[model samples]
Target: MTRPVATKVAFEDGWKAADTITLDETARYRRRMVMTSDNGVEFLLDLGEARLLRHGDGLVLDDGRVIEVHAAPEKLYRVAAQDPHHMLRLAWHLGNRHCPSQIMEDCMLIRRDHTLRAMLEGLGAAVTEIEAAFDPEGGAYGESHGQHGHHHGHHHD
Candidate 1:
């Protein structure tokens, strides 16, 4: 049998997905890849360009079936501060380090890093290790999936 191909993404709601694929933050960003649904159906994902797949987004298959995107739980650090101002300061520190962080009203979420954890602790930020889905802010240029378009083609280390 021929494999199904997913070439489009549907962000609108109300479409019942035929299957779901749970992926971590890294796996959710792709331009082309072979993916397997949660229930064991495999398909090819071929998009015009790499994009971040958010939870609830649907991968539209050639056969008209939608495969839902689910964000899988991952190890992360939940950083909080004594107040909103302090929280902003903590966020600044994370941003300065170019860390991918999910900024929230009360806290910030980032992937676990020993050095960063130590820095946050020294900065008086309350850092707690937790497991949750990470959806970081988009790139500086407003593009999702953290692809920073630099004139010099600089890459993130």
Candidate 2:
């Protein structure tokens, strides 16, 4: 049997989901891929452009079924500073390194990395390991840089 294709994403509220698909941070960003729902329903996610799917977002299939997106729990570091100013400084350091972080009022969440953890600790930030769903900022240039007239790529060594 052919898999149902999801060509659209529904951001508006009030749409009931037939099933849910949990994905990690990396898996949440995609343009075209085959995905399996938590309840075992398989579907194709085929969009015109890659998108950062957020928790609670719905993937609308051609057959009118909606599958909810769930952010899967991941191992991460919760970084906190002595004060707001310190926190901002820490955030700046993280951004300078182009680290994807989830900024919060009291703390920041980042994927677990020994180097980053040591750097943050050296900078006077308290780092604690935890497991939680991560929803990071889309960056200053947004998800796609085409609108900004330039393309910036991230490389990890």
Candidate 3:
């Protein structure tokens, strides 16, 4: 069996602005040591390679990833609590933020599918329900399943 290769989670500490590893406000952290090609972490989005256009009220990740939290509820509440107008915007994102996507609980690390489902299960949802909702063609994207393809299978909690 092939041994697991090492991976670089973040940029080396004490890295300078001029360092070859170029990351802007919305930066995409690539896994260097393991897979240099595939993106390891997607934190901030460097909008069209501009430096001055940095996100102000974003998260400076533990790994210095600089992920821009676009109206994340917890962060929004912290930053703009006093402002009624800004708070309204926060409420909007909370109500309409993508469902399948999971929000991070802490400021440390972001979680993917299985981990996210586990966290959601803690709240009051199931992985199978979410998966079925996203299934194309027959999914309950917006329309309820009619007298069409219906099936069931084993699922893990």
* Tens-place lDDT digits, model 3, residues 13-68: 34332112223212322222221112344332322222221111232333443432
TM-score of each: 0.89, 0.88, 0.19
Compose the digit string of candidate 2's lDDT tens values, residues 1-157.
8999999888777999999999998999889999999999999999988877877778999999999988888899999899999999999999999999987768899999999999999999999999887877776755741222321221111
**Ranking under TM-score, best-scoring first?**
1, 2, 3
Name the better of 1 and 3 by lDDT: 1
lDDT of 1 at 149: 21
Find the 10 residues in a row with the least total lDDT in model 2. 148-157
Clashing pairs in 1: none
lDDT (tens digit, per residue) of candidate 1 on 1-157: 9899999988766889999999999999899999999999899999988888876778999999999988898999999899988898888899999999887767889999999999999999988989887878877675667443212221111
